[model samples]
Each structure stands twice: as C-alpha cells, then as structure tokens.
Target chain A: MENVVELTNVTKTFKDFSIKNMDLQVKQGFVTGFIGANGAGKSTTIKMIMNLLRPDAGEVKLFGLDYKTHEKAMKERIGFVYDGNVFFDGLNLKDIKRIVAPAYKQWDDTLFYRYVEQFELPLTKAMKTFSKGMQMKASLAIALSHHAELIIMDEPTAGLDPIFRRELLDLLQELMMDGDRTIFFSTHITTDLDRIADYIAFIQSGELVFNQSIHEVAENYALVKGGLELLDRDTEKAFIHIHRAPTGFEALADNMKAVKSIFGDTVVIERASLEDIMYYMKGGVPHV
Target chain B: MKIIISNSSKEPIYEQITSQIKSAILAGELQEGTAIPSMRKLAKDLKISVITTKRAYEELEKAGFIYSIVGKGSFIAEQNLEVIKEKKLKVIEEQLGAVVTNSREIGLSLNELQQLLKIIYEGEG
Candidate 1:
C-alpha cells in the first residue's frame, strides 16, 4: 500500500525542544492517528509535513512525491485543520465559499453545501459569531468538500461535544469508504483514536516510541495490576514503565503473552487502553 | 445483526466484539450462512477503530463462529448441534463462575446466591 504521508529521519530544532531523528509513514486509505502529550512534538512533526515549519534536516513526501520539489502539487491534494481556528474573523461562510473553495481544482460546491447542512453552519454568519465547534465544523466542511486525497487534522476534537466529535469521525469514516482517500488525525485524545484510528504513531519528547497498527498495540500491551510484592518478580520488573502506587503498582507490558505466562493466574491481566500505554510510557503516576 | 459492546468495560474493544458475535451465533440470533457486515462497514456503523473491528472478525473466523471467503464477506459457520451445545454450556459456566465468585466476595451464602441468580435469570426469561 502507498503511504499518503512519509517522513524519513526528519529532524527539526528549536530553542527549547526539537523533533529529533523521526521516521514515520501514514498508510493510504487508513485513519492514522498521531498521539502524544503536550510538548511531545506532535504539532512540530505536523508543521514540518505541511512545510509551515522548515525541517532542519530530512525529507517529507506526500503522494510519493518530494514535499519540497512538489510542494504545490503535494499541498493541492492536502487539507489541513490546525488546533484552533485558522480563518479570517471578518469572513462570513459565504465569503469562504466564494473565495477560499476556489483555490482547489477539485472543489465541489455541491459537497460544500452538503457539509454546511450536515454541520449546521449558517452561510450568512460571520465566522467570529460561530462557536468553537461551529468554527471547527466549517473548517472540516471546507476540508472535506475540497475532495483532498489526504486530510491532516491537528487536535480537531479538543473541545467539541461528544456528538460533534462523533459526527466528524463518522464523516471521516465515510470519506475513506471509497478506499482512495486517507486521513491523518493528530490528537492527544486517545479515546477518539480508540474508535477510528487504524494505525497509531506515538511521540515522546521529540522521539518516536512506537508506530504500529492499533490492533497490535491493543493486543500486545496489557495493564498488569498487582500488589507491591508482584514487583519483586523479574518478569514484571521488565515492563515498560512501573508505577509505584499508594495501594499497589500498575505496569504496562508490551509482551502481554509472556507476562501472562510468567505470572500465571496471580497477576490481573486487564485489557489496556491506548491512553494506558501512553501514560505508562511517559512514567505517569497511577491515578487508580 | 445483534451486536454487543460496552464503552467503558475493562475488556478490550475487539475481544468484546469477538465474544459477543460468537455468543450471538451460538444463541441462533445470527443463523449459520447469514452474511455478516464487512469489517469496514461494521467499524463505520459501530463507530470503532477499523483495525479493532477487523481483529474481532479475524478471531471469530479463527474460532469457527464465522468464516470469511476471500472477495466475499464473513458468514456464520455452520456447526454441529453437539458442538453448539457445548459452547453454550461453556459460556454459561463462565458467567456462573463470575457470579458465584462475586457472591462469595460480598459474603452471600450459596443459597442466597442461588436465589439471586434464579431471580435474575427468571426476570430475563
């Protein structure tokens, strides 16, 4: 399968932090999730892909074309939605429709109108008057209507209600049904990823931790909950991150099969969520 | 098709999907040779990760509750009546064991637990 987005040893440096020596790919026709906590370099990698932030080294390719040499062609097939509103406040929905949508060759007014109706945005209302959710919906509407082959969204569901989030996800799912389009969903919200993401890429302090299929992660990583005494077991100590808790310790293991075999029936082998793996990988304090 | 899922259940999403579909087949809710939704369509309808749904379908195929013929979608596998009966009994034993363990943990006597289980089962019937 072709990768919709590809990065090879990509590196970007800043005064404070940098995305270092990263390589990743977003498979075609799959909803690839980019997950990380704050300052985990998720945004940085996205910006580099968009060419909004120049990478100090390495290459980015979209549609199997060089990102630098074919920047215009690459961007034409791409639609981006950043974390916050990225539209002119003075522009009304009609203005966006009349002016912005014309920038793409595949722009379809019919599709735009469908999204407008589905998202419940008023064509006459200025964007400033719209709620954050409405603003996001508008952006998404434009992104979808443009008929972009690859859509990259950054934290698009950060503050939306559950209903809109579902709506947006459903729309994305629908778009990929034809098996020609792809979506790169960047968010810290693991729950949403749990529902829609096919592949997941985890970033930690500007480095890649894991980039694999969601099924692989869910099936392999397990949240092993046990008492403090269980920590003494050599097998349990080999977990990715071992958190000492008030009552007991919770650890995440990539080799869940091995852990279960070693511990037998004593250790509780509970299914781990995407958040659980990310949390433990970051050395988080156990909340429960 | 009847589908079972728990949003906040401790079980992994895929396993829940796999087991529920298996039970539905065993209960005759999903009949043998009935065409099931493709993994993509099922994921879209359930609003779940596609890979997760695919895994569920894969496991179901492995366990013989369903089988997929390439190019065509998945279908419930026809099983011998004896095998179905055994599978249903195993499911019941697992549920009953969970209830009995919980009852003991909460200090309920065996008789009381039996009465509670009977009441719940009767209500379901």
Candidate 2:
C-alpha cells in the first residue's frame, strides 16, 4: 500500500513526558485516526510529522520523501486544521484567506468561497468573535479549499456540538470519495472514529499501543463475560484486562479465538467497540 | 433494498450491511445485473464509515453476490443456484448455531428446543 506519512523510530522528549521510539505509517486513500487520553504523546507525534517539532532521533517522511528535503512543496500538499485558530483573532475570514491561501500552490479562491458558503461562515466577522464550532468550520473551509493530497486535523470536532460534529464527519466522508486524499484525524473522541476511521493508531502515556485497521481491531478483540467463578487466575491470565463484579466477571481479550477456546460458549462473548477496547486496554474499571 | 444500522446493537455495522444485501439478493428484491451504489456513496448515505461500507462490498463480491466493473459501479451478480443454496445454508447454520447457544444456556434439551422451534414455526404459518 502507498503511504503518505511515515515516522520511523521517531522520539520526542519534554520535561515530564516523552515519546519513546515510535514508528507509524499513514497509508494513502484512508482516514487514519490517532487517539489517546489527554497528555499522551499524540500532539507531539503530530508535531513531529508536520516538522513543527523536530524529533530527537529518527526520520519523518511525507509522500515517501524526507519532509525537510522539499519542505516547501511538501507543505503545499498538506492542509491542516488544529484546535483553536492558527490565524490572528482579529482577522476576518476573507483577510485570513488572503494571507493563508498564497502559500498553497493550488489554492482556489472559488473553492474557498464555495466552502465559506457551504459552511455558512461569516465572511467579514473577526475570527475571535466566532463560536468554537464556527471557528472550526472556518478552519476546515481553509483546509478543504486548497487542492491538498493529505489533510491533517487535530481534534477538529472536539468541542463542537453533535450537529456540527456530524456535519464535519460527513464532510470527511465526502472527501474520501475522491479515493486519493489521505486524512490524518487525531482526536480523543473514539466514538467519532467508530463511524469513519479506516485505520486507528492509539497512544497511551507516551507509548504506542496498536495501529491497525478498524476491522482488525473490532474483530480481533472481544468482551468475555461469565460467572465470577470463571475468574480463576488462569482465566485472568488469558485476558488483556479483566473487570469483576459480584454477579459476574468481564474481560477484554485481544485474541478472540484464544478466549473462545478457553471459555467456550459457556461464557458470553460480545463484540467490542473501539472505545471499549481503548478503555479496557488502559486497565479500565474493575469495580465490584 | 434497505439497510438498518444501530449503534446500540451488538451486530457490527459492516455485517448488518452485508447481511441486508445478501438477503435482498436471495429474496430477488434485487435482480441480477442491477447496479448498486459505490462504496463511498453508500457510506455517505448511511452516515457510516467508508471502510465499513467498503468491507461490506468486498464481502459481497467475494461471496459472488456482486461484481464490479472498472470505474463503473458494482452490480448484483447472476444467480448460480448452487452458490445461492450454499450461501443460504451457511446463513441458516449461523442462525442455528446461535439458537443452540441460547438453548443450551437456558438449559433446554435438544428435543425441547426442537419442539419450541416447531411450535413457533407452525404458529407463524
């Protein structure tokens, strides 16, 4: 498969948190969602990929070439939308576009205005006065206006209401229709990923947990539940993480087949969601 | 053909799509050679993940229920009696397997389970 973003053994460190040797690949023609709890290295990793923060070691590549070699051209191919505005708060949509659009090689004014109309953004209002949802929409308008091959967004829908969130997800789906644009969607909202993500890469406490296709994640893991009697040490060992209650015990097993073989149909096995897997893998609740 | 997806339901979204399409084919609601929406189009309409729809289309193609032409949309495949029969049997086996599990969990014997199924089937008729 063609990869649009590749990070090989990338490492970044801060005073209190650090990303260990992390290897990531965002393939072409898909939406790859990066998710983690707050304070995880998601932002650090994204910054490294964008060259906003240089990695302490290893390389970051875009379009299969080192990001630094042809930074100007490579930057042109990527459209970015991050939390808060990347523009001056005093600038209206039109003024902001005038400043930002000149940098992209294929920026189209007609397309930009079209998105402005579609998103119902106020063309003359200062960005700072816009609602959070409108600001995000305005940012997305900018991102989608240019003919970008890859669009990277960091929590684009994090604080928006459900209506706008759905609209944003719908837009992302429409964008994928072209079949050539690759999207890097980073968010803490795992539920949003359930509907649109092709591949999901998760980070926890600066550690890479898993990066796999949605099908693999959903199919390969299962929620195993049965009477509390089944909570013997050996059975617990078979689970990725286990939760117990007085009436029953439940566990998330990474290897569904292994769990089935161990417990058989005596215990109920349920399809696990992305959120369920994430929470359980993080050693989620085990309340009794 | 109609496909209903529920976030709260236990069935995976992709499986719901495939099963619905498969049933449509078996019931002849979708005639052979009928063109179907592209995977992206279906996903957009369903407001679901593109990958989920893609997986559904892939499984349908793999099962010989649909075929795609380059650049053109996928269409329902010509029915092969043997293939359709085999596929339907597999669906039945899956349903029966679930029945077995439920019955066993409830401590119902095989004979009792069969009797209950007969009563339900006859009552429906």
Please name the candidate that would achieve the greatest DockQ relative to the true structure: 2
Per candidate, the number of residue pairs that clash is 2, 0
Worst 10 residues of 1 chain A by lDDT: A279-288
Clashing residue pairs for model 2: none
Task: Summarize candidate 1's per-residue lDDT along B22-59 as a digit string, tens digits.
Answer: 76776678888999998888888888877778788888
Model 1 misplaced stretches (Cα beyond 4 Å): A232-236, A283-288, B8-11, B19-34, B61-125
Instruction: Name the best candidate (by TM-score).
Output: 2
Candidate 2's displacement at residue A193, Å, is 1.2
Candidate 2 lDDT over residue span A143-222, tens digit each: 98888999999889889999889888989999988888999989988878988899999888777788899889877889
Q: What is the lDDT of residue A104 in candidate 2?
A: 80
